[model samples]
Target: MPEDAPERVEGHTTRRVLVTGAASGLGAALTAAFRARGDEVLATDVVSTPLDHRDGPVEHREHDVLRLDVTSDDDWAAALATVEERWGGLDILVNNAGVAGGGRIDVAGLDEWEWITGINLFGVVRGCRTFVPMLKRQRSGQIVNVASLAGLVHPAGMASYNAVKAGVVALTETLGHELAPYDVGASVVCPSYFRTNLMDSLRGADEALGGVVTALVETSPFTADEIAAAVLAGLDAGEEVILPDPAARAAWELKQTDRAAYVDQMRRQAARLDQLA
Candidate 1:
């Protein structure tokens, strides 16, 4: 970005932000980043872990997406009511909650796939279902759904996660178009790697599958702060899609040019990864 670009982009400031999955990692980083910029941030996550950061204007809370299940209309209604009571009107919402499902689509149990998609995909859907109305009432707001580079270009061994994130990307894209009438912007963030407890947070249908995913995460290399910065940039620029890393953008470009070729290339890469393993 140009020296003045950030300043120009951030010319306007947001009053309030609600970030899901804020117990740690990118969610935690985002809470601090937004608060540092003078926004009142309400960060929530399923875990009841203590939020130890003290660098900004942040209010932390425990939020279980399962409790706020998007699949449940009543739950969505209640959660929205609670959010309305706390902030009056929410200016921005970052749907950053997700889980990793193993790549073995064919062999992965149906229950495991369902569990992951419910959290990773339907989680975002529920957020939109619950919050979009309020945002519309406010007439100006932003919804940032945290997808993955997998959403843009799937690699082998992440079938469920890839599918859900791809759904998030598609949903947010359509949402952006739908929200334009209300002057509300929707953005889908596709990030690669990102150092986070994502490995530890895996909620598989069983223990053995969880172990497989945990091993893979040990090799991923993306920083939470970097991804947070990318998210902030997307919000500031009013971008419809945010690719948090250069490699993610490159991968996306490759997929766009030749999707079949991209899949074959990823298969080769996976073979190399297996060799390393």
Candidate 2:
């Protein structure tokens, strides 16, 4: 361990975990990963889809994240009511529900931006806000918010997605600070491209908004299982932000070294990608 690095909490065997967006992608993987480790896992998603493929037991809930709209108090109340009834108290809360946004700032519609921010950014805020009390009651609990590599380094071609994820990163950091008094921990997951149904989900949303964003998903590399594994390891280590991939970690380093230089580099990379297309 580094001399200045914070000590990590040991991973416990009997933790009760709730993962949102558990119908598919990283959330599903996380649910399975937790279950495999003998943790009681309750998986929730808007869609009711069977998640266990390996006889790895996991409870399921058809949760509508948008119904709570994170920004609405009424919705948060209803969602927390459901949560309380299910687990009684939560040991870990993973806010993983999100959507992809297509179009540039000059062309992207405001409604699309609103929808993206509501789910990607405000969703984390709502989850943390509502769960802090539950976690405090437990005395020790962790909250993990799923951001993206774009959150660390806002890239072009997907302005709204970048902006919303960046907001998640910021919100998670601030919440981590505020919740310290309660012994409630917070972490943000920032990952690069992961091979999962994430692209299919984005493609569906893109159909309603426009079809530009699907192309980006089609070309990305990485796997949800790998990302999930890294996240579990990070949680075991009590990291504030769990970065699973090299591109994402490098982006964080670049941001720390030189913000302007990082922006310039991303601009040049975006131009190169444009040329490739």
Candidate 3:
């Protein structure tokens, strides 16, 4: 253990957790859930302000909220320093910061691709790179990377989003095996469309496709809080790949059980998008 590491209790129930992009949506919900469960949560986001409770309430009574831009190495280093100083060590790291983006292959520019990749895929990459060594040294801790259902079920007009989210899934799966020897568990959350402010960060050239995605997000029955609850439960169950919602589970099941049908469905969706265009 490091000199500053906190003494590990034999049966410590409370965890020291750091969550990224905790200002809104699922990130905020996860922070609230962890805190509610008696865990010490360090909620960090790019914004240096308080949680926007307009979406929903998250306890903010002097709890540590740091400004962490996931794309910035300096910010990640500063966050790691804060964790070591304040908590001595971390029990969990949630790489949940990401922006929504999608477009047809030809329509979405390379700049947009780079932008989303920086914050979505590479953001998670940086978090894991920065923290995995510490977790390995400690031989403890869990990493939960928040990916989208699109990561598993790729659809039309979402090439950029699908690719990056799939990258997150692959990364998390690989970490699951690679970190197991060190006793550090990894899980990737793939949730279907849920009621979230994810659309607020959406950047894409295809307005119609963006509108369709926004509608799916807004009209979904599930909420971020609900998904957060499922995630906590999934973590407790030690699940490697957490499909947090019914839709996600169903889609994945379909793909696994009926490959031809799944491909046909994807093709049909693509044709529909084409019609809309």
Q: Per-residue lDDT tens digits of candidate 1, residues 1-277?
A: 3332212225556477878777677787887777667676766666555342322334442332223334556765776777778768988888987766664555578887888888888888888988898899889999999998888787666678889999999999999999899999999999876567777656554445455556545566657777887788887787788998887888889889988889899889667545544
Decreasing lDDT order of the candidates: 3, 1, 2
lDDT of 2 at 123: 75
Computed on alpha carbons, the lDDT of every model, listed in order, comes to 0.74, 0.72, 0.90
Best by TM-score: 3
Tell me how candidate 3 scores on lDDT.
Answer: 0.90
What candidate 3 gets wrong by more than 4 Å, as runs, is 1-12, 52-59
Candidate 1: where is the Cα deviation over 4 Å? 1-14, 52-75, 203-221, 258-261, 270-277
Deviation from native of the Cα of residue 216 in model 1, angstroms:
6.0
Q: For model 3, where is the 10-residue window of minimal lDDT?
A: 1-10
122: Cα error in model 2, Å = 1.9
Q: Specify the highest-lDDT model's number.
A: 3
Of 1 and 2, the candidate ranking higher by lDDT? 1
lDDT of 2 by residue, 138-175 (tens): 77888899999878777666778888888888988998
lDDT of 2 at 125: 77
Clashing pairs in 1: 103-157, 103-158, 194-222, 195-222
Model 2 segments beyond 4 Å from truth? 1-11, 51-79, 203-216, 219-221, 258-261, 272-277
Cα miss at 66, model 2 (Å)? 14
> For each candidate, C-alpha RMSD in Å?
5.9, 7.3, 4.4
